[model samples]
Target: MISNLNEPDFIFLLKSGDTSAYQQLITVYKKTVYNTCLNLLQNSEDAEDICQEVFVTVFQSIHQFKGESKLTTWVYRIAVTKSLDYVRMKKRKKRFGFMRSIFSEESNEPIYDRPNFIHPGVLLENKERTEILFRAIDQLPENQKTAFVLNKLEQLSYVEVAEVMEVTVSSVESLLFRAKQNLKKILGDYYKENEK
Candidate 1:
């Protein structure tokens, strides 16, 4: 049903409260959104939760979409923003968790921040290397990390990444360049420290 519909028609159907259209929308984009959230979040449950949140936001905000970008680009933008926001909120909670434990008489166990990252794009045999690469990717500054994830991991074209990131193609290029350089240094230091 959706395959025959053009963008305007699909948007119209979605905005008009067509249930099938909305279902089709989720069917088409769920994996894309889930993978994006997972890569940024590195937690399956959080990714699943945020994937649902992205669709809810899309549903609520479809009217605000002015057709300035492709639907997929807009959806990707929402997913990226939601993922980063989740990460930020988690960081804030972690920062204050110690205080919470102190005041609440909770167990004094050390809070481990890093989850076991398993990128859906990675092969099982390459899990160790993938984890190392992702750890290095996490060390990058936010914009660079986002660009690297969308372009390299998500395989979005530079133009698509630019649209999702709301930046020029040149900016995406610069971010990726700097991201690569930073990743190399980070990974190099990791190996150096572990070479004992």
Candidate 2:
């Protein structure tokens, strides 16, 4: 479908409206797309939907491909935009019922996996604390949280992140610096309070 797809083949296929080539594109990049969406949304269903939408958008816009960047980078830029927009929309929806929302619900996380050396019981004991940490991450301003996750968890280079985030490399560095500082303060306070 994509023929060679090392670079030139992809440009030709995409520009020629070869739908089969799009299928190959999705197959090759599906896991990365799904996982990146999951990292942003924190919900499986949302991630799945967003991944599908991303592929659709990419295919529809393929004719506009200007070769300004590599295909992968172009697709990733779309993924980042869709994901950030989803977060903002969700934030707006939650703003009205925000307080009751937090106190009235129990988290629905199941299927915990632990290290082999650790007992299941011990793992459960730590699970709530881990949930708290994730909640703190969720509470972070979205941009800072995005930087932290992409840089720390996904291991993207600052330059790669800059392209995805549509910013300069120095801006990415500053964003991550502030994110790290804020996370340390928030997480450290949580631990100190628990210790006391």
- Strongest candidate by lDDT: 1
Q: lDDT per prediction?
A: 0.91, 0.74
User: Which regions of candidate 2 fall more than 4 Å away from where they truly are?
Assistant: 1-3, 97-130
lDDT of 2 by residue, 78-105 (tens): 8878988988877666563455455566
User: Which 10 consecutive residues of model 2 have the lowest summed lDDT?
Assistant: 111-120
Error of 2 at 178 (Å): 1.0
- TM-scores of all predicted structures: 0.93, 0.78
Predicted structure 1: clash tally: 0
Relative to the unseen true structure, what is the C-alpha lDDT of residue 83 in candidate 2, on a scale of 0 to 100?
Answer: 88
- Model 1 over residues 107-144: C-alpha lDDT tens digits? 67676486768676678899899988988888889899
Clash number by candidate, in order:
0, 0
